[model samples]
Target: MATVSEFVIERIREWGVRRVFGYPGDGIGEFDGALGKAERAGEGLEYIRPTHEEIAAFMATAHAKFTGEVGVCIATSSPGGFHLINGLYDAKMDNQPVVAIVGQQGLDSLGTFNQQESHLERTFSDVAAYVQTIVSPAQAQAVVDTAFRTAITRLQPCVIILPHDVQGQKMVEPGPEMWQSRSSAVAPSIRIAPPLEQLQAAADVINAGERVTFLVGAGANGATAEVLEAAELAGAGVITSLRGKQVVPSDVPFHTQQLGLLGSRASYQQMKDCDTLVLLGTNYPYGQFLPATGQARAVQIDLRPEQLGMRYPTEVSIWADVKATLDGLLPLLTRKEDRSWQEKVIADMAKWDDELTAQAEQTYDDGVNPRRVYQELNKRLPAGAIVTADAGTTADWYGHYIRLHDGMLGDLSGRLASMLAAMPYAEAAKFAFPDRAVVCTIGDGAFQMLGMNELITIKKYLSRWSDPTFIVLVLHNDDLTQVSWEMRTEDGNPVWSTSQDVESVDYAGWARLLGFNGITVTEDDDVAAAWDAAFAHRGVTLIDAHTSKNVPPLPPHITFEFAKNTAKALLSGDPEGFGAIKDSATSLVTEGVERVKGALRRDDRDHGDDGS
Candidate 1:
């Protein structure tokens, strides 16, 4: 008879899972042994063990994001399971389907203070949609089936725990009439779309307004053509959430890159001025950047029913797959006769482009401008490249500079915004599509935290990938840059020197030690050459970019309250404030000009004013 561990391994592949990310431990020794036997036979999942269980979980989530399949990760009890939580929370927050298989002590060891004995159900309850522990051999199949099912249907993480002894036990067949003898089948692919009446109602809202803005999100993946068709028909300006940045081409005339602090000024104005807001598959959390309450008549369409109308008040809501819903609604929308609104959006983006160029070229005393790193890479990115960014300043630069062409992919921890996910995510992308080049953009603070370990994991698997262009763009600012900025902008406080400073590392040295090409960059003149060498390298390459600590990753719009607080903090002798203020003086002037432009436009609407 097959052992329970062997059966579980086989069952997941039947559900179309080909890869499993994990770290090993004695608690899961039985499952590891079974997997080993299958690998020898060349008939099992391609399991990749990350440096840590946390990286494993991060890889699992990234696999799901890149492949659009349920990602599976295995771990042992206690520390292994605990380490997986942050990455699991990342998946839970991002609404990705991931299944975690964790191990525990034997059933006999319950309440006996056994080593690595953990009741993971209580711990994972908050992050996982379904949590269960297998007890009897008869219960194995049902538990495994339910975990995958729940994860797929709910678009959330699921946890399955197995006691150490139970996995290695002989498979015992229960009597047919027994309650535990239930059989299960693999789930089939599914597509969902709302009824015609609901789609028609949403289209009616779009057709009623002249200045419409479409806010797109990751849920709109695979619906690029539909988004464009619907937008063209309505003459709408497109604003994507960071998660949905790759869903549409950044170069489109009507598209205004992204919307939020890390987003574009054009995106900000598109939201502020639009009379109609059409939300497509996005629950963009920041409400202030959106039109004020009662400012726009809104329409929201999404696959998740619970997400509809929760962010903003919508006159019509459609709960369905974004691609199918848009296809259905295309006929109902009427092409706008006036192209003025879209033309104005195009002009705004063009103007914002000039502002971004000016910001990127600003001189920094310590090193090259931080924004210049992303800007240079944006120009040199190869076709079909996959880009991943860690949380903090990297995300700011990525959101501000990186442009995703069709067929290219880009993602990060998004909602959870975890620090070290970018490296693992880039690794997983390489695993999922070995032929595609992957560029990981991360800051020094995050890179020092677990990202360096994952580089070893990359070294282990680098030969397996067909494309040799695996690049790690490490920004060295010697500070927890994002947190420092948040303290200055959000809290209205000076930079806390003790907690914010980071220990510098030879980021390129580590890569060279691992037998890969490594480049250290400090001067602005060396930036382009560093990127060129990294991309052209036939193996993993690291660019240790010494960026300026004082470069502020400015928001699309700064609130008056935040401005006053920033002034106060600078006046209070924030260590880096003076230099940062000097660097950002031109940006302040540009913001003031935009504000005047906005005031005149609003005043025009208030009175009866002529066209621009």
Candidate 2:
């Protein structure tokens, strides 16, 4: 009969989990042993040992996002499991499928004060979609099944807590049959087709409108063709949320642009000018950019009924799959042959795209042009390349300039905007997709936060893979510039701030010391050359591009007002007001700008001042 370790390995194999990411600890020793046995037996599953448990979770999150499958991570008891919370929260927020198996304190030590003992279930209750603890060997199979189902079905993180005693205990009876089937869980209460009356009503609204707009979101992932067809049929302009940017090609004629903080003016303008707006699986939270009642009718279609009218008010909410709804409505709608509105929106999109391209092409002597580097990399990187980004200024640069190709995948921790997620995410990507090129772009501050330790994880994974190649680009600005700039008052006085001195650490040298090929480039002209060398290297490679700390990100038009207020508060040394300003400055600025812009376009004199 197979031992507990053997059973665990068999279960992982049954689930078709090719790789696992996490650090090892005493509580997880049995599972580690099981992994070793499986590897020796040629089960094809490999363990990726990352430096930090949080990094492990981030890597798993990336794997899930890229592969559209349940990515798994394992951690030890107490602090180890605690470390996974940050990344797990990110996965939950992004609706990515990820499963975490956390080692719990031995069952014998339950209710007693012991080292590494903590309330694992309560700790992760808020962050995870579902949490379960395996108290006995008999409960293992059910717990695992529930955890996997919860994660895949909800497209969120699930935690399975396994105590060492339960993991090591011998099962008195045979475990449940190993379920080898691999299928995504059905979205609860999804209707493939909308009600006939509602569908015709939506069609009538579109057919009657002179100018129609289609806004797509990430939830429209599988309905790309239908969305494009609907736009063509109705002569409507198309705009996407940031999450939906890559769902449709940006170069599509009717594809206006994205709308939000990092969105282009063309998309926002088109939304306001339209007579009718069709929201296809989008829950865009910024209502200021959306049209008010009586200006334009908003029709929303989504598989999840709960998400239909959660954000912006919808005139018609269809509870149907995006593709089916579009297919049904297309035949009922009258095709408008007029290309005037389409041409105008397309031209605006082109102009915005050109402006961005021109801005990215600009060269600076002292600073490394991050835009230039991103453009060059985008041109040269292989199709389906997995790119992971660290938060801060680097994220802003990538969000504004980088254009993803058809098969390319990009992953980043949003909302919280944590630093140091890139390198570890890259490692996890490599483990999950060994054949695809994995690239990580990180800022100097973010790189330093988790850089030195990830090399060992890379080396360990490299040794395991038959042929491993990981490329990392560190934007070496030599300072924590984002925060530093934010803390500077308008009068050029330093407010509440930390020293920008970065100690000038040699990132390339550190990479070399960690047994990877490292290249350092100081000149802008050497960037391509460094990239070429790093890509050509067979194993892990790091390219440190020395950049200027003063190359601040372009201020968003909406952020100016908040910036003024924050600067004023800082100058006056009003700690309370400064704190308030700091908390809501970015969001308030975005709302203020949109409100003003919307009012300006309406051409109503009686309306309040646009500056308000």
Candidate 3:
């Protein structure tokens, strides 16, 4: 007779889960034994054990996001399960498919306050699309199957609770033949394209509007050509959610930039002035960034009907797959003859790009401007590199400076904005594609927080990867710069000593100790060489580039209210605060002036050409 745990593992393998991320613990002994047996026989799944359950969860999340496979993570009872929440939430908010299997205390001790006993179902309810507890061996197969299916179908986390006692129980019908048949017969969930009529309606809305803007999200993953075709037909400007940044190549003429706090001014202007807003596969949460109702008619297309117009009011809401919908709409689209609006948006994007370039080229007091660091990194970035950034200033730099090319996969903690996710995501990305270049840009404080320990996980797994170019680019400013900017701009307060102060560590030296090719760079002149070296290295590399602490992560559109708050903080008896404000203002104002001059020069050239 097969044990219940064996059936559970079989069910997971049946779903094509070859590798799982997790750590071993007390209540998971039976499952662990089954895993060990499978490994000994050299026939089944591989378990990747991270030091912390949290890292395991993050690794799983990253695996799902990068590979488009259902990621799995396992943990022991209460504390272990609890640690998985933050990473699970990252998967949930980003709409990635992942399943978490958590062990529980014996069913008999349910109400007796057993060791590490907690209601995991209730705890995981908010984060998961499906949550269930396996009470008996009979329920094991169904529960595991349901969890895997729900996770993939819903694109969210699914949790299954298995009590220690139930794990050891005998399965009624589980054997080698049963497992073999299950694995062979199981198929992925099929998704049908949206109806032709709905796609036509969306096209009609585009034809009716004079100036339409395409606001895309992560849902439009594989429909890049369709999107660009539609944009060309409609003469539309393209703006993306941070998650959708990789959808529209930054170098494209119609692509303005991202929208919202981390977005560009060109994106905001395009959205503000457009007569129609077409939302594709993105539930962009910031309604404020979108054109107000009555200002512009809106149309939303998404896979799920419930997400339609949830963020902004819509005229037509189409429920369908993004690629399929675009496929249907492309033929029906009435090509626009007038390209004035599109050209205008493109011109604005050029101006913004110039201003940004000017800012990036300027060296600050510390002789290292982080913007310049990103510019250099972006210039030297290898084709098809998988890039990840921690939440905060590092992400801001990536959004503002880096131009994602075609075939390059990039991920940030989109809605969750969780720190320390970048490093683990990079590790997972490298693991998934051992031949690809996987790089993580992280803040110093964030690197110190959770990323420091995960380096060991990367080091341990490095040997398995074949010629992996795994690089960790640490922005060593020794402070929580993003939070400091937030406190100043939002609360009108000087950055508290605790937020501004962090002990600087020799990150390169630390990585060197762990057998990685480590290089510490403090000069701006050495930035490019460091990147070149890291990307060229066959093994793991760490580039600890010390940057200026005073440089703030300025938003694309600076509001008067934010400026007022920042001024108040600067004047509120803080010398460092004043210096920060002055430096940021100088850089921005200088860039603005340069942009104006460039525009004037372009106008003069155009006039001179006409006269000639």
For residue 65, model 3's alpha carbon misses the true position, in angstroms, by 1.2
lDDT of 1 by residue, 1-612 (tens): 899998898888888899999999988889999999999999888999988999999999999999999999999988899999999999998989999999898999877888888678998999999999999788888889999988888889999998889999887665676487575756844468778888888888899999999999999988999999999999999999998999999878888899989999899999889999999889899998999999999999887789999999999988778898888899999999998999999978877777777677766887788788889999998889999999998999999999999889999998899998999999999999999889999999999999999888988887888887899989998999999888888888999999999998999999999998889998998999999888878889999999988887789887798787777777688998778787666567755665667567667867988756
TM-score versus the correct structure, for each prediction: 0.95, 0.82, 0.95
Cα RMSD of predicted structure 3 = 2.9
How would you encode candidate 2's per-residue C-alpha lDDT over 1-612 as one tens digit per residue? 555556655676676677778788987777777777778889846677778998889888878866666788889999889989888987887777899989888887867889998888999999998898877666666667667777766778999888887777775443345743233223233337887899889998898888899998766776788888888888999987766766676558778656754567678778779999999877777787787767888799876577788767778999777887877888888888897999878866765565556555545555666766776676677776777777766776666665666666666765456788777777776776788788898988777777668877777657665556688888886667566555542333344434655657888998899888999888778778887787788888888888655444543344565456446645565333343344334334444555555455455534654644
Of 1 and 2, the candidate ahead on TM-score is 1
Any idea what lDDT model 2 has?
A: 0.73
**By summed lDDT, which 10 consecutive residues of candidate 1 come out lowest?**
181-190
List ranges where model 3 is wrong by over 4 Å. 174-190, 609-612
The per-candidate count of clashes, in order, stands at: 0, 0, 0
Q: Rate the local accuracy (lDDT) of all candidates.
A: 0.89, 0.73, 0.84
How far out, in Å, is residue 372 in model 1? Answer: 1.0
Q: How much does each candidate deviate from the true structure in C-alpha RMSD?
A: 3.4, 7.3, 2.9
Specify the highest-lDDT model's number: 1
